[model samples]
Target: MSDKELTTKKYWEAYYKNSHVNKQHILTVCSYYSPIWEIFISNSEVSKSLIEIGGFPGRYLAYLANRYNIEPTCLDYNSDLTQIEGSFMEMDVQHYHIIKEDFIKFKPKLKYDYVMSNGFIEHFKNYDDILDLHVKYMSENGRLLVMIPNMKGYIQFYKYLVDYKNLKIHNLKCMKLKVFEDFAERHNLSILHLGYYGGFPLGIHQKINFLQKIIYKLHRLVFKYFANDKLKKYPSKYFSSAIVGVFEKQ
Candidate 1:
């Protein structure tokens, strides 16, 4: 499956139907980005408004609400979202709101202090349009946080060579840091930070074969036993599985 096919609602719905992993908890998402969020939120004050695009379940936003006291909002088109065990409606955090609509066409009367998306941009060939929409909702000096699979990184190289069959189902674009730089230039966004970090490996998804599953477990064990905590804070295209960028509107 190409990234195009993988991003379709049909594929994701089917994928979600079979997966029960991190579906119900904000802890997983918050813990994964704790280092990145620490840096991103360091100089900023709490209570800043934030909106997450396509952040279904809204667990991370809920976590932010609890951790930073920031007002949280999420935009998604999942009308049946309440059926999910961990959807936004289930989170206990206060001041968390949901806008159930197509994110591309969503327009709010009030702008946000921060805009975020994880694993979102790589889905569409027209990433510019989607990114521009995120920017349009940001207040002046507002920040944008985007996280995606690192196509140009060493992890991808390993996957291509070792788990080539499993990798094909992901349908991720070969997006490099430069692609984001281009978007920043075109949109009057300044690159505050850009780097790679550890993330969920490809083979853990439900569609992978048994051999890929073994490889995934082995990769997790290696990271658990041998990875350096400090070094993991620094982004390396050659080593990190995920790329993260923090941008500020100029």
Candidate 2:
């Protein structure tokens, strides 16, 4: 199936319908243990106006709003964004806007200081088109942060074992840091940072069978006891769970 078909509104609707807003899950993502925190800390001087494309549940966006006191806007195609609004309210994020519209067709009057997407762009075969949308809505010198799950090596192996269907939607070719580097050079955007992030015990955010769960438990125990610190210190393309890029429109 094509990328478009794989990531249809119906698909996302079904996804959100089954997903509940877990405050603990959101807190964990914002915590220091997560590599996402590293990105936030590194870019501490980022702007006050931000928008997140495909930001459902608004976990990262809400965290950014709370942490940095930035105004946040969430643009998503799904109508289920009411749940995200509810989540924001629960998080005590009082000031935020949720736009229910296809990002490709979205035309905002005001540009954002930061354009961000987490696990968003890989859903498209023509990812440059998505990247262009990010740049399009960004103000001059604004930062664009794009993050994707690293499905290139052992992480891919684990994803295939646990969630093959979910794995099929992502464009694995675009997961490389070189792709972002080349794109930044071509688009005249300065690459502030681009690299693989996080390490070991892949984030298998999908349902698994009993045997698979037991195996994953064992895997976690082994990593916790022996390799957690070492793996985290040495996040490579093959071992890291995510690939992140921060670029400035110059």
Best model number under lDDT: 2
Off by over 4 Å in 2: 1-5, 32-47, 205-215
Candidate 2, 65-158: lDDT as tens digits: 7767788899888777667876676567889998888887778888988888888888888887777778888787788888887898876887
Compute the lDDT of residue 146 as modeled in candidate 2.
88
Per-residue CA lDDT of model 1 for 1-250, tens digit only, reads 2333336566555545543324345576577788778756644565598888877656677776666778888777665464332443445454567788767656677788888998777677667666677778888888889987766655667677456654664535536777778889989888888877774354444356677667777776776566635447655666667878899878
| Local distance difference test, candidate 1 | 0.68
**Candidate 1 regions off by >4 Å?**
1-6, 17-24, 42-46, 83-91, 157-166, 169-174, 199-203, 207-214, 228-234
Alpha-carbon lDDT, every model: 0.68, 0.77
**Candidate 1 — worst ten consecutive residues by lDDT sum?**
82-91
